[model samples]
Target: MWMGEGFVSEIQHNRGREDTMDDVGHRYLRELVQRCMVLVGKMGSLGKIKTCRMHDLMRDFCVSKAQEENFLHINNILSLKLCEVQNNKVRRLAVILESDENYIEGVKFNEYPYLSYRVCCKLELGNLNYLQTLVNVRPKTIQIPTWFKFNLLQVLKVRNKKGAQDAIQMLISRCPLIEKLHLYGHLKKLPEAHQFSPNLAKLTLSGTKLEEDPMETLKKLPNLKILCFRQAFEKISKYESVGRASFNGKNMVCSKGGFPLLQYLFLGTLYYLEEWRVEEGAMPSLCRLEIEFCSRLKMIPDGLRFIATLQELKIIDMPKPFIDSLNEGGPDFDKVKHVHSLVLKSFCQRMIIVSS
Candidate 1:
């Protein structure tokens, strides 16, 4: 499942490197599918298998072999025994609690010093130095332990219901080598740091609110390639009109030489965006731009036509006034007519595709 999900290549890509999957990873996945070792699920828009599921028989066989070799340990109980910890040479551990009362309180990591992957709801991460991937864990505050170091860590994903902006920032700073990061929850604003993770290439933020223009800060990221902001901006007005009132003083302006290597940009569900100004030299390498559900966005940035690398532009569920301005002979038609592929969609009608 992990191989089919492209997580391996994704890690390489996030590290600001090309994913050379055609040589080994793709061939291995193909062989697995041909041998009926994996079940293909869904195809992506590019005609590649986007999802796959492991066969039940294969999964059982692997589990039995893993248990036999003590490579992995699955603990469903509320507590762990010191004897079990001392006995098993588990390298990967999965703890699944059957009830809310069950917690990850007594599990000891000293027994399994080589533990690399951990999946649990709660943990005390002081001893897991070799840990490479951490998921479903949220620290209470931003005060990370001075003794903890994620030197080899590549992926960190957290969901904090209370929104730990400072903690998230601290985590990013601590893991200098981290490449892919996903933060989910309510965050009023990101940290006002001058520099962020240098190698970070992909970032996804959901249910976040920014007090300042996000582009002003994000544009400084040198290696960022894919950025998605979904329901992350705060709206000040409910009216379907375009004006400064809708933005609450958060207008985006891309400066010269910004986002030098960015390729994919998605802005969705930003209900109160009023204006976006794109400077001529900004996002020089951008190839795809998508704006969706930003009803109050006034018009397409005229400076976008200056981006020679732009290939795809999509506008979905936007206000009629905004869509009308982009149609043939409309005020903004000339600004976007040069794009190789364009798609516009609204609730009132079917999607329209335009190509040049």
Candidate 2:
């Protein structure tokens, strides 16, 4: 919230000549400035004004009256300004820099002695009651608050170098109804045979690996519509006894019932593509598929038999035979009358057109 001297001069200039200022004129102008600040701060806390406006207004007020305001005066007014925030606190609350840092510097927790209001240094999402989506990139480790139980959470993204994966599992376990989840580098091992939310629609697991196959976790998600595995590098030792590591083979992706409602699928540079068990009835509703940088793929399994409604298929940086299998299948061509576009790229580019 740093303001240059030029800004102060501009405000004074806008206030007009000192000679023209009667007692009423000075009083009204000062009151007007204070009134605007109070209204803006209140509106910000009430979630009426955009967050940016609140930050801007606070910055301007602070800069305009630096000499007149002290730490206590500023802190008291800002606290009163923020008291208007009602219940159902926003999960994605962005604490702008203009927010009262003195007030932010006052939250306290007794148990975590190492991380008091002082160690925390800033108040990001401490006092919020309904925060479900939180991703802060400060030097702090996000520990899930105990009060946070099953709520109406649908999306979560968190990144911390330490305890990254554990945090993700904790959130997933807590929010059983979460519909979409994206994790970037947080999760050492997938949950050990736990039931996932049946309402899960989209999942993105990036930048992590596991000693065990994570297919069982996917099996728990009955309503999963979109699945993405991006840059998830697994240890070579994890696949020692595994058969050919390719979803493109005679026997790949196999499950009890398969992806019953899955529609979109993306597998990116995943070293252990062999873990996918292209089970029968899996991907019954699959429509879009993209496989990129899966060098280990030998062939796409014939078990992908029931993708009857597939519309778009994309294969990149895979073996020759894998591409051949897809070309031979013609995209369950009998049922996928809606599928008119296909893209295959390797050393060259080829586009195919299909019609009903």
Model 2 lDDT at residue 270: 63
In candidate 2, stretches whose alpha carbon ends up further than 4 angstroms from where it belongs are 1-127, 136-140, 144-147, 160-165, 192-195, 232-252, 274-277, 328-340, 347-356
Q: lDDT of each structure? A: 0.68, 0.51
User: In candidate 2, what are the lDDT values of residues 1-356, reduced to their tens digit?
Assistant: 01111212222334575431223333444464577653332331112232222357686766557535422122343343343323323211223444445325433322210121223454444344434344332224445466665454545554434355545566567666666666555356665435456677777777654444555557567777887777633344965532222122221344657667778888777655553446557677878878776767655544454556777877786665555555536543333334556665653435432332
Best by TM-score: 1
- Report clash pairs, candidate 1: none
Q: Pick the candidate with the highest lDDT.
A: 1
lDDT of 1 by residue, 253-350 (tens): 88899899888988877766778899999999999999988777788888998999999999988878788888888899989888888888875767
Off by over 4 Å in 1: 1-52, 67-105, 109-122, 141-144, 161-163, 192-195, 232-249, 351-356
Q: What is the Cα-based lDDT of residue 208 in candidate 1?
A: 62
